[model samples]
Target: MEHTGPDAHPWLVALEQSGLGVAMRQSLLLYPAVEILHIFGFVLLVGSIVGFDLRMLGLAARLPVAPFARHAVPLAMLGFCLAAPMGLLLFATEATSIAANTAFRFKLTCIAIGLLNAAAFHLGPWRSLLQRGEVTMAAKLGAVVSLLAWSGAIIGGRLIAYL
Candidate 1:
């Protein structure tokens, strides 16, 4: 397969010339609706994970970590799934700049780490622990990792526009 240079991608040029991006380029409101959707999705994810993770870490709710995790997993998944498409939408509008940006690379790396963390949690011992309706050391560890990954993803994403 022939790889296209970043500058040569037709998609990138289209995005750069998109009326939406060009119109709001100067205002903080650029892609306001898209950004809003992204934020809303992230908040949902935070709400789901935070609540579940905290409960696993001995917070209120006293939910069996397994059950709590079960419910929270969907929300976390939803949040991430929604945010990803929205993020990609924004990136499409400026792929050339984003691809060369350090913050964007970092954001992508963090997301990769997050996905790996989730997969590891799913396939490792935490899976059985979660099945038992009690939090184990592994569960706590996973929760901490989840918190860090998601938090880092958020920070990296926010920094994208700034940096």
Candidate 2:
């Protein structure tokens, strides 16, 4: 692996040279398996989150948000659990190029934004949602942000291969 410019950093070099990274690159089936797992994770995470967000946005006004959130949030958390470590492993395989990739950076930024939005919502509006018996403007805004952030992350992830 040729390292140059930003990709020449020691940690990136070391990551790409690690046993996990080497194994990922050497075994075609392993890489594909990991990729499939990663895809499954995102599907669960994003799909559940989107469903919750739509509810917050008043898609199914008749359905109580609290119960929906209770069910969906756990799935989102589980998805994150599966995706995060797999993502790190995938990154290890081509740390240098992946680190330098514009799409990768965008995806990371979007993920950070999405996480922060979730945190803010849970800490703020979410606590009152049950008692309030209605979605607050803050919750709606958070839902919109969540939708856009996760969607952008997905778009950026897909573009990573091309760009």
Candidate 3:
């Protein structure tokens, strides 16, 4: 697909021409290193989230939900910290093309849905359930949704290379 000219936003042009973007595209070692870091970050992020969701699904029923969240939430947030900037840098390296990619768009949509689902859980049933130390149908449903959304996001991200 055509990615440049008037179709490309000014910000995307600037990003493509920026020093970091140029370096990321041009430097063999840097690009691979960045990709590796991105992989690690997402691995941590998704792994932690899925693990936590499994816990909510009764994998470790003996463990208190609140305490599990205390550990899991921070780990997931740390993974986000690691992943998000690296992902942005990777995007900046090929902004226009990635922007036009169907898989990329789907991946972003899944991420948004996943985040919204998480927020709804925390804001709604999860808070009270955590306090009460009881799992509910709603909580389990949220866990299922979280697992599906994140898994879909990961799948979409992987498909970016082929699609």
Give Cα-based local distance difference scores for all models.
Answer: 0.74, 0.91, 0.87
Estimated TM-score per prediction? 0.78, 0.96, 0.93
Where does candidate 1 stray beyond 4 Å? 1-30
Query: Candidate 2's residue-wise lDDT over 1-163, tens digit each?
Result: 4454663799998998999999999997998898888989988999999999999998999998888988999999999888888888899999988888899999999999999999999999998897788799999999999999999999999998898
Predicted candidate 1 versus true structure: per-residue lDDT over 31-83, tens digit per residue = 78788888988898778977876776788745566666678889889998898
Per-residue CA lDDT of model 3 for 52-118, tens digit only, reads 8998899988987887888888888888788888999988887877888899999999889889988
Candidate 2 residue 99 C-alpha distance from true site, Å: 0.3
lDDT of 3 at 33: 89
lDDT of 3 at 77: 81
Candidate number of the best lDDT: 2
Ranking by lDDT: 2, 3, 1
Weakest 10 consecutive residues, lDDT, candidate 2? 1-10
Considering summed lDDT, which 10 consecutive residues are worst modelled in model 1?
1-10
Output the number of the TM-score-best candidate.
2
TM-score of 1: 0.78
